[model samples]
Target chain A: MRSNTFKTLLLGAVFLGAGAVAASAGTLDDVKAKGFVQCGVNGAGLAGFGAPDDAGNWKGLDVDACRAVAAAVFGDPSKVKYTGLSAKERFTALQSKEIDMLARNSTNTMSRDTQLGITFTGVNYYDGQGFMVKKALGVSSAKDLNGASVCVQSGTTTELNLADYFKSNGMTFNAVVFEKQEEADAAYDAGRCDAYTTDASGLYSIRLKMTNPDDSIVLPEIISKEPLGPAVRQGDDQWESIVRWSHYAMLIAEEFGVTQANVDEMKSSENPEVQRLLGVGEGVDFGTPIGLTKDWAYNIIKGVGNYGESFERNVGEGSPLKIARGLNALWTKGGLQYAPPIR
Target chain B: MTLRDKTADETPRSWVRAVLYDATIRGWVFQGLVLLALILFAVWVVHNTAANLRAANIPFGFDFLNMRAGFDISQKPIDYTLDSSHAQAFKVGLLNTIIVSVLGIILATIIGFVVGISRLSRNWLLARAATVYIETLRNVPLLLQLLFWYKAVLSVLPGPRQGYVLPFSANLSNRGLTMPRPIPGEGFEIVMWSVPVAVALAWAIARWAKNRQAATGQSFPVFRASLGIVVGLPVVLFVVLGAPLSFEIPELKGFNFAGGMVVHPELIAMLLGISLYTATFIAETVRAGILAVSTGQSEAAFSLGLRPRQTMRLIVVPQAMRVIIPPLTSQYLNLTKNSSLALAIGYPDLVAVFAGSTLNITGHAIEVIAITMAVYLALSLITAALMNWFNARVALVER
Candidate 1:
């Protein structure tokens, strides 16, 4: 009787799952037909990435990436719809086909790609784990964190990195854990912990929210590599290419000096590389490869400018984050943001 | 007449006869068809998943669990490092979940009982206050409450440099509550062993006293005598062992408390939120259970010259428990399940660590999700089984 019941239930589950799979064609086909991308973003208040303004307008580095993809495909950046997701809901939303892409400051790792059934296109920001301590502690480096209370967000790479750093150094530190970065920041600021640790980019964003930013200093140490990038659902090869090339086009456009302001004029430039990037004179057939327009790169550059321009305006030297390019600079400038040749 | 009877004795068609003559066989055939369809469907899904994973160039395996978890865990009960295996990370996460769930259960029960009793209070103000608490808390979503606690309450606390001093060498700050940690000295192990031994001795004494009272009609003062032995024996052992215990008081260092156990604010907030939210529901359950035991039972006990305390303890509570156990079991399960909200505050619970981070790190969504679901299901089943056993013991036996 038990075996029979189990078999019946198994049959029901199989039919349900199969029905769901069969009803939904590939996500790639659906995305192309829609003509605009649906991107998920961090709804939390991470300043440089996805925080809202006082007027309630969403703007950030991650947000710009989504807009750039929209520009590349639809010729209008505003055509994209941004669905805000909390950290926990972000992946599931993408997996459920609620969003076409996730442009949050998500770290690219092997486990997420293969296990979670997602694919990270390429790294846009190279970050590292670091610690921030109050000035009164007189601590300059992570080495001085002996027996210190460290406030760390739980369920993050920072948490494990913190344990490793302390244990490896043979130091015993108390952990004042929080579930969210904002809570950890609050605790750190309120003297709940001697220090706060997270990704360096996050540290900067969090530090800006401190009441006395001058009283805290981020240690000049990078622990773990956090290669944050945009990702798409797995099995969507065409959509993946479109997103990947969209980001790469931004890089190539920056390399060729195709600023948003000069994009129209740059189309008729004498330089072959500039002309090719702006969709002039037998431009590389990006439209054919990714099932978009040949001028997809042109729309991207014209709408959001190139990578350098986006960085400076959103989170670089000009922004409140005031972060240096570091590894995010162009490959020719001895950084890691290298784009494949457009050919 | 014999020839006619012989002609009429011919059997029906074989297939018709099989269906008509055997109910079990018919049932088996029907069930078999359903099973075959299910197997075919499963094969198709497996095939699609394989194809999808292959196309994406992603390997599907559990080998990732053996790899080093390069991240740090802030509130690990056991020793953990970034170099620890992913399985170790998961264990740490599970331990954190258990810690929060246990604490939340105790707190919720206390609050629940108080509110439950207050709801029945004769005083108008007290009843209204209890009603307000239940209505307000039970209505709001738990996730929002957790976020509010973390973001609004705990975050607004004073920093470590300006820590709030509580009684008995404890500090409350945004960092968390810091308390004096007990450090074991030499010969402390012997003193620790005395605690359980003393309790066991007390239990034996109580049993003996109860039997004597029943047989000889003599009161032995079991409560007072057992209490003395349980309390005194441990203290005597500690003193005899030359006070082999010390406390490491939490001191304010340059900017924060050091040299003591630090509770993380995430844990504090999550615990507070879960306990407070679940308490309201538990309060309603307790009230309903108590009310389910008719007022006549308590009145009967009172008329027999029993004190109010005895009436409640001996008569009402036992009967009320029959009404309470099932729902109480569900409340406990709810608390355990709600511990998954630890993800909101980054508590690294089982779901957050294994299902979230590990799944992300390993890309084994199917396996990770299945494991997570199975763990929760097992926990719920175990809780239900225990409650069922308790209910059976307390249930009235009808001849």
Candidate 2:
């Protein structure tokens, strides 16, 4: 009788374990079954990062990241729906499976990776917190911002960095915070703040959209490191790899000097690495390892180009933001972007 | 109202049938089943929530409150710094919420009463003006109104460099209303203590006068005497202590003011939004309440030779208060909840600082939201309890 009871208990435990496994399915399958990728992008209107343009097209570096992932997964960048999320709502949206991945220029902080039920795929944009002030204010350095009222967006790393920078330097300042980036911009334009602070890249974005772009200038002080990147919900290695490699594919294409226009012709390149990345003659199918088609990297390049191309069109010199590819250039250049070999 | 009533003969046909088929017993059984189902549903919810959290690998616990809130609140109500723990931030948020809600309530009540009475004025212009004010303020959404006020404040005022100097050396600018900081000298505490002591003395005098009036059928000038004690003692102490206070004028140092007390524009916009929008509802409530009291009460008071103002004070308002207190409690609760819209304009209320900023920092959405909801719920309950006690006091004795 005792042995029979123990066997029944063991059988019940096995059924429970099987039930748990069936519930937490992979996100890639969900995206494929749904026929599109739901990506969380910036809703707080940080323009060149992730905001919809006047023509209703979502055009930004972060938006391109989502499109690249969708292109890799479904072989079409347009097979993606964007959910614009604010800084405060992004992680909860990701954790609750409201989106496939968050590409809203979120910083990959240690606490967020280990604690927030989400993991950063890779750094898509390297940023640091900086200040923007009116040129009329005559503030040359951030050090002169003592006793200043600085407008900043809430629920961001900028506020903490501002406080730390001020406190450690033995200065006092007032922070006028707003929930949305546009509101902070409006306040700064309206002269409610002496300086506006955000990620340095975002400062360029903010300056471009200000009422008088010529009146304001971004200050030359980077207060804190903010490795802005795309992130996915934790505990799904298959989905994580698919998203992580989508970014690496962009960098590798950039490293090989592969432009979107030349991708079709370069499919026949003699270089083994280029052939491996574009899946032409490398003999090995790179996409199968990450559960995609053989032309996964090729689709991303064709859809959103390499990282440099996307950056130039959205926020770099090709666009109005005019930001230089300082830290975001390929590893062959004197920049930080590096990707492992595809083969 | 007992379970068994007289002249009911059907249940006694059989002891078994009676126990099984009696109305009270059947009611109890069905209610018990409903209670069981509710309990089971609650248990299922808790079990599923835990299971889902475990499956997603999201930690669901209150331990996050002990973590450092590495974010900075724009308006710190207490001594919260960037290095403070999330628990301390929660306290700062709670205190800020209380400060705004209390100030908004007091301001809204004063305006509501004035407008409510104005809407019923004998003069046509006053009543029509009050009506227009109510219609305009109530029709606009509170969020839009907040944005309007905040944007207006930012646009209307000049920057700190070109701020308008108001009376008493206060500076009015887009940043805020900056006034001189009051530095307390060594003996300012003695003068401060005298004010509260005078209030206690006034309370004692009022009690003694009330008893004398009850025994001798004579009323005393309690209001004037208590007002004197409260104000006069403070003034006398100030003179005796040689008024040990100094004012430090704010100077344009770097980019803004230094050595000043600043009232942030975000708080101003939030206070204005809650007060103006809530006052209209309160005005309507007061108007309805005054109309609720029967005209016969006023007629009876006039029949007793009371004048119009005396009749209103003695009969109409007292009767109207019973109707007003309940809805007024609702408006108070609404005001407290509406203050959470402070998040839109970036006032560091409990929701903005704790649930919005700290939640973003710690990524503990569940715990942060739960704590914020509990704080609002507790605030509402406390307000309701106080209003209920007042409601009971003014409730009809019905002797």
Candidate 3:
């Protein structure tokens, strides 16, 4: 009688464990069944980062990141919908499953990763706190901003960084803060502040919106490290791997000198690395474990272009933003991007 | 059936019928049913919120209040740093909200009373002008007014490079209005303490003068005497203490002012928006209250040899106040609640700092929002209680 009851309890425990596994295993299948991936993008039109075009089609580096993930999963970059979100609403929207993933320009931090029920895939952009001042101000360095009034957007880490930078340097400054990024931009344009502070990428974005873009100059100092990346809800490891590898596929494609124009030609190359990345090797099915097509990385490169191509097209020298690849280069090229071998 | 002998064998109504027809029992039954429904609904909401939070793995707790608020509040009314706890940040926000609302209330009352009386003035242009002001101000949305003030009006001002210099060595720029801040010297504290004592002495002397007038039919210049004691005593004390005060004038050092008090543009914009918007409603209340008082009281005072000012002061004002206080108290509450709009302009009010930035940072929405609502509710109740007390003091005491 005692043995029988113990067996029954063991059976109950097994069922509960299976139920927990089943609950988290469906996010990938759910996205596929829904026929489109829902991606959260910045709503306030950060120029080269995430903004909708005149035809209402989303465009930018962040938007392209979402499209690349969709391409990897569904073999079609267009199988994605964009939801514009503000800084305050992005994480909650992700946690609530209101969106499948967030590709907005969000900085990955320790607390957010562990506490907010979200996982950072990888750094899509290496950003840092920087200041932009009117060229006429003749302030060459951030340290020269002593006693200057700076306009900043409230509810962001940039505010804390600004305070720390100034305080550590033994200088005092004033912050003229606003709720919206556009408000801060407009205030800066109207000369309500001596400098406007945000991420370096954001400084470039705002400069494009300025009345006289040439009249302003971004300062040289980077006060804080902001590793902006994509994030997804933290429960399903399958979904996280899919998002993480989608970005890695692009990075590996860039390292192999593959572009959208040459991906078809590279498919026939004898290089083992290229063949494996394109999923054309014996007993090679890297995508099936992640519940994606075998040619997932190939589809991403073909449909969304490689990482270097996306960067140049959206925010780098090929685009109007003209931002150089400072620290975003590959590990082989003296930068931080290093992806694991596809084999 | 109509007379008396038709129902000799009639029995009492059934218990169900009797109870249904009983007003007191019916009332209690319905009330209990409603109370049960409300309780169930509240429980369902709390349960659903907890379930959702658990499913999302978002921890629901107030431990976030102890976390470091890694942000800077530019307009903090108290000492705060980036290392400050979220609880201290909340206190700073609450203090700012109180300061702006109290200042807005005082300014709105003065403007409202002036505009209200002018609307009832005998001069045609003055009345019409006041009427136009009320219509325009009341009809416009307060948010739009705030945006207009912050963006269009203040932002368009010249930069600090060409700050508009004003008299008394003050400066006005898009940053703010910068002026001299007064610093109290050695004996200024003593002089400050004397003013309150002078006010109390003045009150006692006024009471004595009133009693003397009533008992001996002798007139005394009570108003002048009280005014002299209140104003003159402070001045004499200051002079006797060798005028222990100094002014620190603001100077244009770098990008903005230094060495003085700075009234930020956000504060000015919110103050202007809230006061101007609320004054129109208060003006209408005042006008209606004054109009509700019968004109006969005014004529009766005049016939009793009272001047126009005396009739207004002694007879009309007291009755008008009884009608005004209730709605006026609500107006004060509305103004306080409306000050939350300071968030839109980054005024660092309670809602902006605590409910907004803190909630966003910590991700504990339910707790933060509940605390904010409770604070506003408590403030409204306290204001209502105080106003009710003042209302009772002015109420008619009939023999």
Every model's DockQ: 0.28, 0.32, 0.24
Q: After best superposition, candidate 1 residue B261: deviation in angstroms?
A: 3.3
TM-score of each: 0.82, 0.92, 0.89
lDDT tens readout by residue for model 2, B79-124: 9777889899899889989989999999999999999989989999
Error of 1 at A145 (Å): 3.9
Q: lDDT of candidate 2? A: 0.84
Ranking by TM-score: 2, 3, 1
Candidate 3 wrongly placed segments (more than 4 Å): A1-25, A281-283, B1-44, B152-156, B209-221, B395-399
lDDT of each: 0.78, 0.84, 0.84
**Candidate 1 residue lDDT tens string, B338-388:** 888777665668877776666544545555666777887987788789879
Task: Estimate, for each residue in A1-343, the C-alpha lDDT of model 3 and write its tens digit.
Answer: 1121233233223322322232254678889899999999987888777899889888888888899889998999999999887675677667766689998888888878887778999999999999999999889999999998888876677877888899899888887766668777887888878899999999988998899999999999999999999999887889999999999999999999988999999988799889989988777679998888889999999998998899898898988889988898888988888899998
- Please give the distance, in angstroms, between residue B35's alpha carbon in candidate 3 and its true position after superposition: 4.5
Question: Which runs of model 2 end up more than 4 angstroms from their true locations?
Answer: A1-24, B1-14, B22-29, B183-197, B204-217, B244-249
Superior candidate under DockQ, 1 versus 3? 1
Poorest stretch of ten by lDDT in candidate 2 chain B: B1-10
lDDT of 2 by residue, A95-137 (tens): 7777889999899888889887789999988889999999998
Q: What is the TM-score of chain B in candidate 2?
A: 0.90
In model 3, the number of clashes is 0
- Backbone clashes in candidate 1 total 28
